[model samples]
Target chain A: MNKKITKQIKELVIARLEIMPNNMKVSIGSYGAFSKDDLKRHVEDEDEIGKKVVEVQMAFLRAIKEGKLYPQE
Target chain B: MPKRMLVTLPDHDITTYYLRAWGKKAVKYAEDHSIEVTSLDRDKANRKNVESYLSNLPFGMVFLNGHGDENTVQGYNNEPIIIAGKNESKLKSTITYAISCSSAMNLGDASIKAGAICYVGYAQDFMFTLDESNSTHPLEDKLAGLFLEHTNIFMSAIAKGSSVSEAYDKAKGSLRESIMVAESSGNRTILSWLLWDYYAFVAKGDISSRL
Candidate 1:
């Protein structure tokens, strides 16, 4: 809900997404499509939908922070 | 009599695009094995056509490729084709597989309770990375293939008469191998989403049930 908090989360998600090979396209089923660059723009924009995308990204980030969302093995 | 199969593949955007293209693998397998396949693609994948086909056909396996949630699976234009607690019975007596988002969380359970033999899908958001360079050609997208191919393999396994448990295991195993391959290759981004998808993949109901 906080714009500053949302911006910080967006940057974090983009940082993670940036590690992929540029050829990759990340898809969240039917929500929307994103190339790496598209992902950056989608997550950082001030639009209502962009805020929701930030929220979703934050959830993934929170899971990662909690550990075990992605196993090392 | 050869068994019948119902396939719904709607082409709308990136996610649906991959599904529509990869679904042909299952369709081809069914045809080669003499399984009667009823395809509902594009606009034909709407609610009315889906309901009509299921109600009129004696299909044994149903594969749906679209977007969905815990309680519903959408078709062309995101129209709800199967809404939990409303028409899950349409899947009665059939083995169902949905390569959608989160329908397995609730719709899968509801359908089984409504009498489906088995339901296979992801419980949470189904994530996959596509190769934009392969936009005009989805099946060749290696990144997307890493995710979608497993589902196709599952469908093919079922078409070849493997039990639901066997097919599910085969798909999950493939996903696990892909994850390892991606990780070893220094690909950090996709591996996490793939692992998430692997964890989300689940099959409910008669595990021994075969199509």
Candidate 2:
């Protein structure tokens, strides 16, 4: 929420997206498909799509932290 | 009485292109099962055609594939076909499955309130990764398959006489399996998106409703 935290998350998301293969593209509903470099640019710009990607990555990290990805019986 | 199904596939852009290609599998499964299918494809996937079909036909299942938001599902060239407050009543008595983004949040609820037997869709953005090399041949893209195949499984289960809840469970189960596969293969990109989709999938109205 803070400016410092926001910048940190942006960097984290960009780093995660950077490892994606160049040939792959992500289609996010009406936002259309985005390539690896395109995603990094979005994150760097902190546009709507960039915020969305950051939200997705944050949600994923939270899920993992809560052990929701693989719940025990 | 014979069962009937209606599907809309709008192929005006790259995103819709993949949706149209994958949506064909559901249409084919319906045809193969002797279910009468009325597909509004390409330019025909408009509000007028969708209204005419729903108003006159007794289709038990409807599959809408295109771009969408919380209140509307677009058709050809992003034409609003089914708007929540305006035409959701047209879905009454039908089991509707929308493979678009975020329509499940509002339109799905509106349709159910308008008497739709059931509704299944994503509450948030329906995201997927595509292999650009297979852009010209979407069905052959294994990366995209990790996401779209679960949707196909849901529609196929419905066509096979599975109840709405049953079909939803089957799709979720398949997604979980795919997630495990992605993790085992150390594909974090695929795993993250798969998890996002799995969480986004939601169903409303009567879960026991079946075609």
Off by over 4 Å in 2: A1-5, A71-73
Q: Which window of ten consecutive residues has the lowest lDDT sum in model 1 chain B?
A: B187-196
lDDT of 1 by residue, B5-86 (tens): 8999899877887789999888999888778899998889999998998898788888999999899999998999999999
C-alpha local distance difference test of each model = 0.82, 0.89
lDDT of 1 by residue, A35-72 (tens): 77776676666554455445555665566688755444
Q: Give the TM-score of candidate 2.
A: 0.96
- What TM-score, computed on C-alpha atoms, does each candidate reach? 0.88, 0.96
Best by lDDT: 2
Where does model 1 exceed 4 Å of error? A1-11, A45-73
What value does DockQ give for candidate 1?
A: 0.46
Fraction of true inter-chain Cα contacts (below 8 Å) kept per model? 0.62, 0.74
Which CAPRI category fits model 1?
acceptable
